[model samples]
Target: MCLLIAIIIYFLFILFLSTLLYPMPVNDSGITRYRTIPWTTLILILINTVIFVAWIGPDMYTQEAGASGTVEYGPSPDYMGKINYYGFRETTLHEGIGVAAFTTFTAMFMHADIWHLFGNMMYLWTFGRRVEDACGSSRFLLFYLLSGVIANVGSVVVTPKLDDIPSIGASGAIAGVMGAYLFLFPGTSVNCLWGIGSLIRLPIAVVQLVTSQQAKFWRWTVSVPAWMLLIWFVISSFIPSVETIRSDQDTVGVNHLAHLAGFFAALTIFLFVRKDLFLRYLQGRSL
Candidate 1:
């Protein structure tokens, strides 16, 4: 919610400032579902903006709570408890439901700081459009939300209780896009500004960065090609490295498990959701 608001306010600020300074209009959509831009995109953005504002607004319902405990805000004396991912204390307006599941989805659009939002949004802006185009708006929404859910569940499964830190970001769902793309459209090209490191063990990273080539991963790997990236990602999910990602908080840190889960979810749903279409397509190709 906070991320959405920041973007809205930022867009308005740009529009107002630009018009006042130069009298120029910002980018306008030239196409839509009928006469206007798709409502799904607009609604998603609006919801994000509303949530963002609510998150930062003065606490009217609860007060700040502990990081490893619960937080309360507001003056009406209303208090609904909240917990961070690792079981630490946090603050929010929602209650009665599993904060765990809520955070699983809600956390995707949240950020602990400006840099976090910047990175996630950058990727979202880059990949979201293409994913929507390929999968259709409604399916994209389902893919995104479900992938996040899978990732969140994966995170919970591997983490110990009392690690109250909350994990939030759009990366898991985005990764699902990459995974799905590897399967559904192998001929599609993806341009990544990836860079690797030096001659040492870390140099491998640099080498990867230097050798990074933009290509249709689907085209590159022919036999069960799409599964390649998914396999690699799944392997990384169980790594214990994220368990120690941050020392300051007791929360389960990186949640690589969630990421792997997103990829599988994407693959599963993409293959099974439209069974009739998939089967018909298969029959059509079998000739």
Candidate 2:
């Protein structure tokens, strides 16, 4: 178990570091008209961060009691047990619908590690504020929870045979937010940090020598259409999900199907957004 944990951490670490080489969303062109402050988005990010740092901190780095009155940090067995017990699982799905349904909610806030939490929270921060602005805090909160539940259900439906594997993370919920962003603010642009130059150690002086500010900016950042990025998210997930199912592989990896499900489920934002915004969307007006 210790070895497994170490390997997982190593893998997560590599993935986390790899982000420096790829384009990552840094900001968006979407504007929040309804609320000046996205209180709900902020609250959600704070809650998720606090829960991981406080509640799951011990799970990842517990001070284990040892001989000679010594204590060493390691993964806590009790904490791991708790996660498996509470996280959405196949047993929960087969035994009782109510209990399994409850796990979906618990699992949304639980994360495997810091990198997992960081990635989800970053995506949430990128796309959630505008979505919250469109739906309002209360409605956005409800929509987020519901999207998580639906995403879990979608995962269970896709891989029902993974009996002991637990599903956890806010990616599915954040995927919904991305989908909502695509739907509600299709015209907006997502500004991403394109670090390929830094990754390859390309001389920035060459680009800096150029007089155009836009050229210098393009050397480090790129602005992509909101719809393109969001649609690519769905397409990217769908291809892997299909390939995985077709190959009949039992290996554990990302739950791409959950992302797809959440993305589609969020298209129903028409039902969750404020009436005025939905009317504007219907009328084909700039939002």
Candidate 3:
């Protein structure tokens, strides 16, 4: 029963990804001025990729000891258990304060799988460049790190203290970028690709084989206002968070409170320091 439910959840996640829309500021035509090189965004993507390859990739791809002391590789059955043994945040709480603090930061760089890393980099690339352009590279770097830290802290605070499940990924920080983009480029039109031919095409392709007639795959671009996309994401995160708080469903994955924390942190900062930018953009003027 659990396996069936897992398969259903996986399919639903794939379906969500297939129809998902991403912001494409570059294809926005005259909406945004490409003022900066966005080297900061590129550097971040490079850093995350390198860390994954140098650190996590070896364990993921190469043969290693499993939780039962057996050898395995390439999607090790006990991969999650093994990773949690290293520096996962929830488990680190039992360790000393120094260890817990270190894990909190390290967990931000760690990812569970290739798909997790890829999805995060995609979102970071989508909105990180524009946010970096609005704020200088140095400030953008600071914002990203601070937002991620706050997000983790929020996760620790809101989650059950006894639940020692490890959480790792860049979703919270990328959500912060989306929040900043919401205020900074609300009026900007972003190009997006819709239908099954979207970013996660490989998974959708497999799904097509099982339900060929029911599956409809098409590739096309649509321009949408940035506010609409950002708002939808924030609300989606919020609903799940509320549900989690109200129920004992054992759904311990995806820390929605952290996403909300990072988002609000970025949004609040922009509201105070970059209010003028918001006003100017709202008035249809370039920053």
Candidate 4:
């Protein structure tokens, strides 16, 4: 029991630290189906967290040169080598089409940093559970992967000049979940944390709220309708995408365009949703 508590604490601490740079959804308003657990959503989060915490995270270095663990040294050749191999790049789409195809699946599992992984995983957990329940595990998994691949393709198509730059992260896939959620449960409330480091411990804040013990943490969380939050996110992506294109900056950065594409691609959720739900949706009935 003690060990499990310690592990949970450790995980929460890491998640808290990671959300400093961006807002993250902690919970949602919708109730899950009876006896149904979102196994696929939980597994994806676990896999992304494990890949970052165990495989790539420990090897991170930002310095020019020194050693693998040294802060002054940059990533080891082995790390860069793996990134080069797995990270998605547009050039490969035409040059090594087979490898390019494979990396579309691989790159979504790899993340540049803990923040990147946590951010994406949080979104996945926040929105994916309901989406998975609506679509079922197998269909949700297929939708997720295809959303990611199409997102990467959209990025490459929009900015061919950055063909060689490698893009990695599950943002695109989770964005698809967000899109699906917007369609399926637009009125659901999303609990979001939006404060700086230490100011946004959502677990603790939620506990405090549940216990009727108000804290400063209350100020950090905002509950918004699913449609409102998702539309804001899409607009945010659109503005940045326009700016990126106009600036003509020759540097790697967030693939905002990919987010947009993933969102739109997920509208095909009609194809993955449970037949009953899809029928209700088509019939203008509440799902």
Candidate 5:
């Protein structure tokens, strides 16, 4: 519902902006090679959906007390996976570790809630189309897993608490996708969305909702570049800082630093594979 409204408002904004910025020419340098769905993305969507439907349901959030300790995990309603109780974090420890490493890349299929899975899947379907279309099947597929690994590691680095608290969701790796997308196509148009009200997403409005989100955030804040936010959000992880600690309920904010790091990592690969081509492209832009 919110995504739909955001799309409309975004188009309107693009209509208005078209008066100034022309749509960049579309490029299909790797058309055939990039046509496959990045496997990592598909795997993540599957994992999240499967997990939500299969192993862990909302009921899993309950009290499991033993000689060891009392674990209480009520249904964690947040899609971003910041459950407030001890049991909420405890119940998913093993699962979280599995995801932290690249081995459980399939875990992307699992989601903590319906809404959470919905948002991640929708984003994957949207931006993922081009990524898979450009990078080729194998690279695109691995890119997601690679990015996810960096994102999880970034979370671990920034929020040591996640070592114990069971953190789930694809936002970290998604950040990596966002990172790679921007690197491959810096000026690419994308949708920029934000919270206008409860259950409402105000489209910052642009041809590309993704780019718009990056531009708007960076334009407003100088210290953090749009690219950096990709990593910063990931680095921040599920743990709330002094700023967010006041919130009474679970809060799984986006991990920014991981997104940035993963993006750079993939970009490094891109550079290695197509150094001359990339340099020429940059030189052309400078000219």
Candidate 6:
């Protein structure tokens, strides 16, 4: 049920974004151009991957019998609990802030599962390269860490009482990369896969009735402008942050407030330090 609700919410959010900012022309042969090898982004991805492999392992699927006599599926509970010791907790908001300061940086490198690591790395690679090019590698690394720290702080501020739950993942820092990407490459295009293969799969009977041959599922890649994609992401995170605050739920899940905070932090930093890049994009000059 939770998975269903999450899928529905994600689908609706994507639909809404599509309506607001339709994808650009399909560029099957478009190539990514970078001024420098995004060493920082690559290093970040490598570090995160190594940590996950060393500690969390690749297998995220686990099952157990539930009270309803049905199998419940989720990540390994033991690993999740173990990782909390390394993740950022709300108790770090005040009295323990000094002692737990290390967790702010450590949590950005930790992930709960393969999917979590892959998704964050994918976004980081997609957006981090451009931002690194704009700000140079050293500054980019500083920006990424700062954004993540600020994001962790934001999460603590929003859920000060929910200290027992630990938040982990590099998404907050990746969100900052995306925020920087929006300004650095406003006119650039991003490739995204869209489909409904997982939402509704027809049974063999229905498939046979529809066609003699077996149904082959597929998804198409569409290219969208950078600004539109980043804006959609920011808005998506913002809505959830607001909803989470309103409901005051004690769920240890995606930290949307952290994502939002990281995004805004990077945006502010970019504006202050690299305003020229933004102005160049606005003036219709490609970087």
Candidate with maximal TM-score: 2
Candidate 2 — which residues are off by over 4 angstroms? 1-16, 61-75, 96-99, 197-209, 212-221, 247-252
| Regions more than 4 Å wrong, model 6 | 1-34, 58-78, 93-99, 196-220, 250-252, 271-284
**Model 3: per-residue Cα lDDT at residue 59:** 62
Among these predictions, the greatest lDDT belongs to 4
Q: What tens digits encode model 5's per-residue C-alpha lDDT throughout 1-287?
A: 99999988986566345322221111212332324545655665676677677655644465546566867555535433433222223224445532233333443444556656666776565456566655555666677766666655554454554445444566555656665655655444443332221112234334345765555432211121333433444345423443333443235453344344455556543632234445745676510
User: What residue runs in model 4 are displaced by over 4 Å at the alpha carbon?
Assistant: 1-23, 62-71, 196-220, 247-252
Encode model 3's per-residue lDDT on 1-287: one tens digit a residue.
99999998996677466556444333342333448787878988898788888877766755768899998766654455556754446557665533566666677777877767876887788788778877777778878877787887776666665246666777777788878877666677666655433455666657876788675654455566778877877897888887776673336577887788888878654533345665776787866
lDDT of each: 0.48, 0.78, 0.69, 0.81, 0.48, 0.71
Q: Model 4, 11-104: lDDT tens per residue?
A: 8777666555555788887886534699999999999889888988887764574466644756767678667888898777678843776888
lDDT, candidate 2, 1-287, per-residue tens: 99999998997667546655555676786667875588888898899899988888666767767887798777688678767867877687678743665888888888888878877887898899888888988999999988888888887677766655777898888888888888888889887765563445355555565755655433455677878778778888988888767765544487787788888788778889989988998899977
RMSD to the hidden true structure, all candidates: 12.5, 5.9, 9.0, 5.5, 11.7, 9.1
User: Which candidate, 3 or 5, would have the higher lDDT against the true structure?
Assistant: 3
lDDT of 6 by residue, 88-199 (tens): 8866544575337688898999887766776688778777776777777788899999899988888668766656578889988888777776655667777754333222
- The TM-score that candidate 1 achieves is 0.50
Candidate 3 lDDT score at position 140 = 82
The better candidate by lDDT, 3 or 4, is 4
Clashes of each: 37, 0, 0, 1, 36, 0
TM-score of each: 0.50, 0.81, 0.70, 0.80, 0.51, 0.70
Worst 10 residues of 1 by lDDT: 21-30
Better structure of 2 and 6 per TM-score: 2
